[model samples]
Target chain A: MKKSLEGRVAIVTGGGGGIGGEVSKWLAKEGAAVVVNDVGSDLSGGGFSSTPADGIVSEIIGSGGDAVANYDSVAQPDGAKRIVNAAMSMFGRLDIVCHAAGIVRDRMVFNMLEEEWDDVINVHLYGALNIVAEAVPIMKSQSYGRIILFSSVSALGNLGQCNYSAAKGGQIGIVQGLADELKVDNITINAVFPGADTRMTEGMSSTARAYIEQWGVSAESSDAQGIRSSVRNAPKVAYLCTEAAANITGQVIGVFGPPMTVYSQRVLMRKLYKSNAWQFDDLDFAIGSSLNRNIPESRLGGKYEQR
Target chain B: MGDRFRGKVALVTGEDHDLIKEISTLFASEGAAIVANCSHSEWVERMVSEINAVDGVAKVGHFDLTSMADAESLLNFTVDSFGKVDVFVSGIEIRDGGSVLDSVPEKWDEIIRPVMKNVFATTKYVSAHMRTQNSGQIVNIIRDKKIHHDISVTNSIITEAIIGFTRTTALDMEKYGVGCNAVISDHARNAALVSAYICSNLVTPGISSIFRVDEQEVSLYSVPAIERGIYSSDIFSVDELNYLVPKYLFDGEELS
Candidate 1:
């Protein structure tokens, strides 16, 4: 097979963490010169250091792949702009933008703090907006690009992930809305609901980890097997980055462990189409008699019957 | 009579099901050694007795799929007895079924944890062994969506994970000549039979999918066994298997 991305230049945000780090390496291996961007902040989005990005860059270079390190927070316009600028200045061209950087602040909806919510929003959603916004102009000028945003399964509404879910879900909307706008420009954008056993999961308590770990699969094993391990989610990201995936865009792909699921845009199911306006009694009768038989209950609504 | 899986060794989980037992019996009847894995000794004894009567090679492995310890024990017992596991059949059945309402935090863990452990532990050890040989096939059985009602969120999650793992494992093991895939069906017999073909030399992993086809008997197989030089089937077929087997294994003899 051809080196699908040979001679391309790519930028991967949060290139220091688990999924992002692997993606950086995989893209570089595909012959793309990478700008490994990581503002090493702890889970709550605190301290920033250059080491995360720097370490990945060095590994790439050591492995005979070209890479440059960018230590910029995606939360700030200046930082986002510089990161994009570095991609062009250092590599002389840019083709892929992978945004996998973010932090988590978990709490119940009622008990969640304003700042906590704001902090997560800034990093996950706004940060994605800032970084991708900056990359858009550069990609447009080139007429060829791939942008992969990091969404989460929480977008489907996890119990204590309102802030994270909101931000990630918005990322999906961004992918959907911008997809058509960029299609004429020959650019493809998509979202990934990634599951990797990376350090980012340090937030989970030991008891929870122990419970989950019984069946938990790490990205490292996936990478090592050269298969779709949770972390091997990187390879799919790399495949999307390549020209081989020219027709795929405005889509959502999920990676947890063994499976890579292509999620459909929501469609109406078991609808009761009406010829004209109906009385409340007619609607109620239809709903009970034909429309809602054994329909799935809402996850958020927390309703369950024997079915 | 044809020995389709001669000299092969198959390790099958889910000993409680009669379908899986018959599947094991078919593999053994075709001359491959069988490892019948179960959680209870009584089921194992019942399974082994029938195999013994047929002059078929078989062994009883009683271990929990949930524990990492037990997973290791299962792998070790299989390897220690059979020398290696060429095909892994994840036919596990957990009857703790319910809907999303049962998808509570505590309940979610209760349901997903054991299945998760079963998948990972098996993959970790068995894939490691297969990687050394650079050749193997893994088949997982999931409930088919055609009859997918009354399903719990817990089983739904488990099925999704198995699928992801299977696809990725297929990708991971491709270079090493190892293939992994899964089948989705309500009837264990159909699933177990399709998996038997997959584990046998007749079927190899070229296309990965959650197989949802009917598993009719050989007499009921309506599709022509051979079509043109392509060899196709509306349902699974041993003839279609020829296309997927490793090229070197054929020694340049074209099946067509």
Candidate 2:
């Protein structure tokens, strides 16, 4: 009997540690040849080391799995190209790309410097673009591919993660935006909002911690539940990259706990119409009377304290 | 009847499209001072003159869609001219067309940088100013009508990203009394009206939402919810999901 991914090849960006590292091991355990790409940047995305990627590759190889280490930064287009090339040269074909590389620059929107915003956006959002841009052609040629962008619950919005949110949020858009187009070639693109305890999240502020608590496991770990562990996120992510999950595309899945969740694609919730241009007073009255039902409570700003 | 924007100042930026022109004019007609920003100086100046001719305060500000410095200056130009900015309307047309597999990395940059990247810069600056005033509305008009099969996947991705960015900005700014929303429309008048309505006092500033405008109808995009879930103590493998998902999620119907 053969493993599920016996002949498949996968590129796991940021596979050096945490969820990405765990995911790399999982894919390898299933018999895929894995390219473990990591810059091994610190929590704030500064400094670099190759040890993370090398360590993960060593572990996989030692466990009777085929894997190679690639120290390429996904934030750059050329780096993404080299990362893909490394996979092809070592494994001959590329079939799966799990982009889990990320960094955080948490700060109040007002206090956030341009560099802070740029750094986070570059690593997370631009990095997603680079990797997918390189891998899509091979997948298209083969008529099969599975791409998973490791977005976060924070993409919806965190009190001090406007930059990170915007980047992760952009990734979700990429998944949805590319879904129909990719579906034509039997390729699938989806987002995974993983709630796990990782080094990237260890330094969260008190307000951010509280925000995560209120939002529950859908956003991050429900620490008390003890079920939404970091490694638990791997199965769902690995599953999405499999042939069994072929029909699922453009979906945003949250893997944090005992029960994995599929989020609804955004749609029209309520509408107000006017034959003529809507006046301020009239539009207000219409929304106030009808559209206000089930309006999402403000999650940030001063509303954060209301909890 | 048109005093909905009385005493307000608006910064309208985007293409030389009729939608951008109409939004500038409509806001001016509703008694708001207008800063019409576009790369085409002659076209925006013409619109500015048209608004000024109608006894509405209007000014022309230049912006290069891909330039962050230009974004900052555009906001500054609005404030310097009008004392303070009350509303910002961004209307950008998506560029390039091709499947992601066919396009190169530079193509992705070309498609994303001008629209989404610039929007991020403008939003960051405009919201910062809005936070101080404790009042403002932002309406991003992404012309999704032309986004079809031939359009690049990068284009679609950026479109979705802008929408997501809109939601995040709305959330981040709501506490400061700033409303951020995206408008998807091909119709000039409808998009203009929706932008005006969202900027109006009636819609609370803290509500970050997406609105689609077609003809006379304005519909709001809903926040995504959990469609369904199955509980378990441990994570399920592919085989287990193959069994349980069909039984529970699809009522025994196979996923096609």
Please name the candidate that would achieve the greatest DockQ relative to the true structure: 2
* Clash pairs for candidate 1: A219-A231, A226-B172, A227-B172, A228-B168, A258-B164, A258-B165, A259-B164, A259-B165, B98-B152
Off by over 4 Å in 1: A202-230, A297-307, B1-256
* Predicted complexes: DockQ each: 0.01, 0.46
Model 1 agreement with the true structure over B1-256: per-residue lDDT tens digits: 2376678888888734765785687678777788888777887778878897878889988888766678778888999998998888877454454532223334534554456456656665676678788888888776543323344434444554455445445544555667676666666665666566556532333223345423331111110011111111121122222232223222333321
| lDDT, candidate 2, A14-81, per-residue tens | 99998899899988987889999999889889999999999999999999999999998999989999
Clash pairs (backbone) in predicted model 2: B98-B152
Task: State candidate 2's DockQ.
Answer: 0.46
lDDT of 1 by residue, A1-307 (tens): 5466788999999987688998898888878999999989887889989888989999999999999999898877688889999988888778999999888887643245556656876677667767777787788899998999988655543445545655675576557656666778888988876766566664543322221222333323335543333345666677778775666677676544443445554323344444444323443365456543444432111122221
lDDT, candidate 2, at B255: 35
| lDDT: worst 10-residue window of model 2 chain B | B144-153
* Model 2 chain A weakest lDDT span, ten residues long: A298-307
